[model samples]
Target: MDFFRIDLSFWLQLQFSARVALRLPAAPRSLRERTFLVPNPILGVFLHWLGGLASGSFYVPYRRVKHWAWETYWLVGGFFSWIIAPWLLALLLTRDLFAVLRE
Candidate 1:
């Protein structure tokens, strides 16, 4: 069975009670497979998305540019990605960006 399907089943069983018995599939066998099992898959997925957004902007240049030389485009894009994007997002998302940054 799919890993996420198994996780969803577990989550729903917990939510509605064991009376909603699913034929829980055999647990993953190997250590690597077992490593993905979480007590709460919803929080796990949301945290993964939050991590992705925190590390975003890597693909900005690749998507928007086709003509500029490698170093030129990357320098410009990296400047915006590393320097401008975080501050811009912080300002837009927070009520007290400057105070938060002071820490």
Candidate 2:
């Protein structure tokens, strides 16, 4: 209903969709299959740009939190951005996530 909830929901959905998409099986070997397996340089660049934009803008939401001390706001934001979101995303995206982490 609110912006935080909406944003969180959107992020969760997007991550889940990405994980599902990435899990699709590759087609058997062929010219087209080889082409598909090759990472597109343009798409790679675009993804990096998008990630930079997202990281740069991550603190924008904190600006709307009035009456909060800077440290309080920053710590709260940092916990979500650095800890919670990454953990949740990794759990969603990876098979044997705990095994990978343990290694």
Candidate 3:
């Protein structure tokens, strides 16, 4: 397959995964819950869209990189972006970064 298809597939998977997490009873609550203890579907949707765009945009840079095996570059970049970046970001955003992974 092509890069766009691969990137979009990963993005959709992440979106679906995040949706499942938000449905959990102990989802760090939400940005809404942190301050007001109320859920906001609007904010959730916006955040989802923002994440989608950010992921797609980050993948764009890989499109310009050439002369390397697709499998090689894709795996390396995907490992850093999907795994490493998320782990660090989760640590910064939530104190319980390992909670969801443990579930």
Candidate 4:
């Protein structure tokens, strides 16, 4: 159903955003030395919010996609967002992206 699709999209976006956030480098020492509003933490929060908004509205743009069935566009976008992009990003950020999978 539409509700289930939306929920799945939201959860997938949250997971992807969390992975991206956790992979980010630590804040600069000068910034970290501050007592409040640490840069990286704040950045993570902002990115999460933006991701949530994008996820909620993902179907809107897909709706306008011409010559493609709903399932086709949704699957294509989901594949890129949830799998391909994550794989490529993880490879760049982590020394061995598959190391976590070995366990």
Candidate 5:
């Protein structure tokens, strides 16, 4: 659909801009270094490993699940992963979750 294409294009543009902005500047000799508060490179490696583990194992568990259609399983997995996990984590971790969400 046209709306989906437009939205995807906007998201891709945003991602590309983020990638560009996150790249290091060429001319450096400044005494002060700016940051985006990204964690250490070691943490990035561990995060990358964890993500790869998750994605690699994504479809395997579905094979053990009998009787459900692919669409059903996919829908359930996507719903919990995209919606439930983040909300649950935030609720558990944040001090004032409702106020932050309201903002």
Candidate 6:
């Protein structure tokens, strides 16, 4: 039972991470260009909705974690979700990531 719960939590985390990655490409740089790059308004709306769903459900996986301090698990998750993943995606998506970050 414990093993199963741990596996489920990891699976949920993976799903949540994938959802976040999918949403990264939809990040809008400017208000004017918000819906321009996307082919249709509906598609943009759907992407935004999906991102919201992912954000809302992201904490569900953490609930399954056991035998650890909340801060310990949160910090580990935060490192991946907030820092490493964003930096990696920005580097992949942007031409001059450092220049963009410096501004």
Choose the strongest candidate by TM-score: 5
TM-score of each: 0.40, 0.49, 0.45, 0.44, 0.58, 0.43
* Candidate 1 segments whose C-alpha is farther than 4 A from its true place: 1-40, 43-65
Q: TM-score order of candidates, best first?
A: 5, 2, 3, 4, 6, 1
> Candidate 6: misplaced stretches above 4 Å?
1-40, 56-64, 101-103
| Candidate 6 lowest-lDDT run of ten | 5-14
lDDT of 4 by residue, 1-103 (tens): 2322232211122236446533334556664443432246776899999999988977777656787987898799889889999889989998876887785
Q: Per-residue CA lDDT of candidate 1, range 11-90, in tens?
A: 32333465666554554455223434446788889999988985685655476576767897779877987899888998
Total colliding residue pairs, candidate 2: 0
Which of candidates 2 and 3 reaches a greater lDDT? 2
| Model 1: residue 86 alpha-carbon error in angstroms | 0.2
Better of 4 and 5 by lDDT: 5
Q: State, as a TM-score between 0 and 1, how close model 2 is to the true structure.
A: 0.49
lDDT of 1 at 14: 34
Q: 1-103 in candidate 2: lDDT tens per residue?
A: 1322222211122236446533334433442222113346998999999999988997788777877998997799889989999999999999989999999
Name the runs in model 4 displaced over 4 angstroms.
Answer: 1-41, 56-64
Candidate 6, residue 77: lDDT: 81
Poorest lDDT segment (10 consecutive residues) of candidate 3:
4-13
Predicted model with the maximum lDDT: 5
Arranged by lDDT, best first: 5, 2, 4, 1, 6, 3
Residue pairs in collision within model 5 = none
- Each model's lDDT comes to 0.65, 0.67, 0.62, 0.66, 0.68, 0.65
RMSD of each: 13.0, 15.7, 15.4, 16.9, 13.6, 19.1
Model 5, span 1-103: residue lDDT tens: 2322232211122236447533333434341232224236887899999999999988887887878988999998999899999999999999999999899
Candidate 3 Cα RMSD after full superposition onto the native fold (Å)? 15.4
Q: What lDDT is obtained when candidate 6 is compared to the true structure?
A: 0.65
Candidate 1 colliding pairs? none
